[model samples]
Target: MKRQLVEELKSRMKLLQEREKSHTAELSHLEHKVKVLTEEASNRRALVDSLKRRLAVASREKSQQEAACLGLRQDLEKKSQRVEALQARVSASERSQSQLEQTATRQLEGLAQQSSLALDALQGRLTQQSSLALDALQGRLGLATKQLEQLTSFTKALASEVLVEVQEVRSELCRKRKRKRLEEVGDVGLKKSSVSRAQAVAASILNMTPTDLLHMLDTPPDTEEASTEDSRRDQEWLEQVMAILQQQIPAAGRLMEAVRVKMKERKVLTEELAALTAPVSEKA
Candidate 1:
């Protein structure tokens, strides 16, 4: 019985030892699982922190882009207003240009008509004045011819009288010299007197004045008849010249009136031309 009891105790001791060994192995496996779970939790926490940082950066970028877009929209609105104002101003300018063109055209047509009328009036006046001038010139030529003929007749009569007087004086001088009969009379005094007398007669026949005759002859003539007739005839000729000049006065007045009218028409035409050309010149 004592031996059987001792063997039972030994068996119990061996079973307890086996149970302890199995429990130790299960605990080591559980410890390894726990270490693996802790490492997984640490890696997941690092990933979550990285994802939160990315979300914050994305939100900031989105806010900045929205601000920039708002500023761009404001600038576009300002530019659109400026463009609208410029368009309105261009339309107003076009309307004003059209109105001005219409006014200029109407004024130009009226000026053209007035200029034509003025030119026609000027032409008619010029024609009348030209005819009057021609008639006046013809009348003056006829009068000059008549005066020239009268002067020729007067000169011939004076020449004939001068020749007769010169011949008589020469005969008297020859007689006086023959009576003296000294070979040649030292009558250089008488000869000089005769030469002076002949020179004076020649000057009178040439229709020179007394003062002019004295310069030509260097002495006085023996006769006074030629000088007296010359003065009387010159006075009569002057009166006839005055009468002819008076007769031309009315024709000169008519010519002056025609010139004045033409000048007035020209002034009117110049003013009309300035008015007509002003608009076109401004555009140029």
Candidate 2:
């Protein structure tokens, strides 16, 4: 019975030792697990702290972006107000410019109408004056032509009378020479008579005294040339008068023509103005 108890006790001791060893191994494993858990927890805590810092930075950036956006909005509002003011000023200036242009155009049209009316009146006066002057000049020219014709006829008649007298005297002198040469007649009466019968006969035909006939015979035959020179001088004077009249007439005509041309231009300008304003008038 004692051996049996000793064997039982040894078995019990062995079991107890085996159980202790198992308990010790289990405790070591649990320690290793605890260490792993602690390291993981520390890593998790660090990641959370980093996330907090990131969040803070993100919030600050968001606040700064918001501030910038507010400033941009304020600047945009100010710029919009300034743009509105500029637009109002432009509208006002445009209105004033339109008013000024309208007034100026009206004034120009008034002046143009006045000038055209004045030119028309002046043209009428000039036309009447030119016509009267032309009539007067024509009458004067007719009178001068009649006088010139009378003077020419008188000169021709006087020249012919002088030529006839000279020819008769020359023929009588030739006849006296022939009588003296052929008849051998010598008479003191023939020599003493310086005024011949031819002179008396010519004087009678010319209705003048012998003394006047002798005087005319003494004058050079170039009397006709002198009379022609006088006539030529009268003609030159008339030509000069005609030249002056021509110049004056042309000047007056040119003035009238210029006035007419101006009137035509004014008419054309009025037509053009009407053409230009037609659409506006229709719209109005």
Give the per-residue lDDT of model 1 (tens digit) for 1-284.
98999899889888888888888888888889888988888888888888889888988988998998998899999989999999899899989989989998999999999999999999999999999999999999899878866754564444344434443443444333333432233344557567557657877789876557644333235334554764565455444433434453325454344434434544554555555456446756
Tens-digit per-residue lDDT, 2-45, candidate 2: 99999999999999999999999999999999999999999999
lDDT computed for candidate 1: 0.64
User: What TM-score, to 2 decimals, does candidate 1 have?
Assistant: 0.29
Model 1 weakest 10-residue run by lDDT: 177-186
Candidate 1 Cα RMSD after full superposition onto the native fold (Å): 31.2
Instruction: Compare the candidates by lDDT and give the number of the best one.
Output: 2
Supply every candidate's count of residue pairs whose N, Cα or C atoms clash at under 3 angstroms. 0, 0
lDDT of 1 at 55: 81
